[model samples]
Target chain A: MRVLGVDPGLTRCGIGVVDGQPGRPISLVDVFVVRTPPTDDIGARLLGVERELERMLATHRPDAVAVERVFSQHNVRTVMGTAQAGAVAIVAAARHGIPVALHTPSEVKAAVTGSGRADKDQVGVMVTRLLRLDAMPKPADAADALALAICHLWRGAANARLSAAAAKVPVSRLPKGSAQKGWR
Target chain B: MRVLGVDPGLTRCGIGVVDGQPGRPISLVDVFVVRTPPTDDIGARLLGVERELERMLATHRPDAVAVERVFSQHNVRTVMGTAQAGAVAIVAAARHGIPVALHTPSEVKAAVTGSGRADKDQVGVMVTRLLRLDAMPKPADAADALALAICHLWRGAANARLSAAAAKVPVSRLPKGSAQKGWR
Candidate 1:
């Protein structure tokens, strides 16, 4: 399964794509970041995001998309930022007909670092280790996105197995190419 | 002078255009609403907003654009909504090279109702009376947007007068049309 994970923001967004099978190690297929100038018009900024996402979708063709769910707090300005970023990511996935799964920050952290309360640095360290990377993912947002993808991979596998077991039928009874469905 | 006002939203956006100068009563040149289905792709939704705004701009050839300024708040989801809406409006204005001005809700309310704390119903009633219309404007968003435009005109005129007064320096030392040049 190939999963595209996105960390959305108005000024900067990070995208990561990973490919792997359900019980096997996931491999990073590609990773990149997009940045928009603060002075640019809002339309131009959104266009930049759309163009980059379109290119990533075309090139990687990930089967599913995972995005960080935004939760607003007291700061109206921060809330606006989170909302714009979330909207952009959601729109990008929706545009491609990709089923999107939104994960909370804690869920992502727990999946990647084995602790829901893990800090950014902890999550980054664990993600690098789990992915067997040469170093920690640069720019915390990219690492967070990758961790989100890894979380999906792990959860997806668990869900698939549970689904197969609950069906009270052999796993082979499922669709023949179902394993390939999640990956583009 | 003509002013176009936009109220941006995820599923539906409202638009209104008015023509007139400050102090003198403004006329409702046009008022309409545009909508995008939730199921539509983000790009398509944006395109819809763009197309509608462009059509209005072309048909009316407004001299200025007025948009609602998003207020920062603690609610992430609400902020996101406002930001997305704001982005669409900003993009539309920028695309046509129109001079865009953002007005706060309170400012618009005060301009239309003579009280910054006016509620929507009060504002609507005041708008009707101010425009000498027979009935309240339809579609609350559109009415609010129109009020925003009216607010801009009122403020713009006051600003113009202030600039003119400030420019009454030694006439010989002043550049011709300097005040007008700055306004433009």
Candidate 2:
């Protein structure tokens, strides 16, 4: 399934599209960034992001959208801006009837580099190799977006399989203690 | 000026509209909440907020929008959702060319109750008295939103006067020592 990954930010938001599924080679479809002037009013800045994301959703038509979830940050202002930008992306996808997934930064790193603690350079290198790009995507946000899409493609497909498998299992076959274990 | 104030949240976003100027007594136009089910997907929840806020903006056609600036919270998830909801309100206002202002929780409380650290009950009581309502607005969110609009009406008017006064001052006429002080 095709996936659109967004690294949301107020000044610059990254958007990348990747086509692939579990056990299949992934290919990069497109990558770009939408930027707003820092001096602009907050409302105008948000509207710019919303409109650009809406345009991208209409142009790409990805099967699913993956957004980098805003976690805690040293700067509360930055966290708020990121969350707002992320919300615009989420709402854009929802308007298009595209399922959206939120991936933590560490989760995206782990999926791309096999290390949750991997740094930006490691993520960039791995994303380049995974997508078979001639060079690294400029503006670290672009590489990060690609990594997010790759993560969703790999993880989402696996999740779907697990869900399908669980659905096919007969209720009578469930282990006596399975209910207590809880599905994580 | 008519002002629309928003207290944004994922489950329930409070919206209130008030009409008046800085010195004049403010009158409440309307107050209500838009709610989304917790069980819904995050994308769907965000979309619900965006659409509702848009509809409110269209119906009210307020001169300005005031949003409660989401502050840091112990729960990261809650903060993100609040920030996202606030962004939707800001964008909806922006789309209609209505200037948007952000007021911190403490600012709203102080404006309504004369105490930045006032409790919820104090805020609700002051808001009801300020609006000259027979009873308090149901749900603390509704009162909070009304307080936010009141804050914006009073504060925004004062801000405009300050800006206008500053604009009238000529830099060249300032005292030599003023250059070192810098313009605030």
Off by over 4 Å in 1: A39-47, A156-184, B10-12, B20-25, B33-65, B72-79, B92-100, B130-132, B156-184
- Tens-place lDDT digits, model 1, residues A100-173: 77777898999888899999999989878878899988898889888888888887778778777757876678
Instruction: Report residue B141 deviation for candidate 1 (angstroms).
Output: 2.0
What tens-digit string does per-residue lDDT give for candidate 2 at A7-116?
A: 99988899999999678799999998889887788887888888878877788899999999777665777777788888888888988899889898998999999999
User: Model 1 over residues B1-184: C-alpha lDDT tens digits?
Assistant: 9999887665667788988875577898888777877665444565566568779988998888887777655344444555666665665565567777777889899998889999999988887887778899877887887898889889888877877787776767667765332100
Candidate 2 clashes between residue pairs 3 or more apart in a chain or in different chains: none
Return the top candidate by TM-score: 2
DockQ-based class of model 1: incorrect
Question: Per-residue lDDT for B58 in model 2?
Answer: 80
For residues B76-179, could you state the per-residue lDDT of candidate 2 as single tens digits?
76777788888778878888899888888998999988999999999999999999999999799899988999999998887778667767899787667552
Candidate 2: stretches off by over 4 Å? A168-184, B170-184
Stretch of 10 with least lDDT, candidate 1 chain A = A175-184
lDDT of each: 0.74, 0.85
> In angstroms, how far off is A18's CA in candidate 2?
0.9
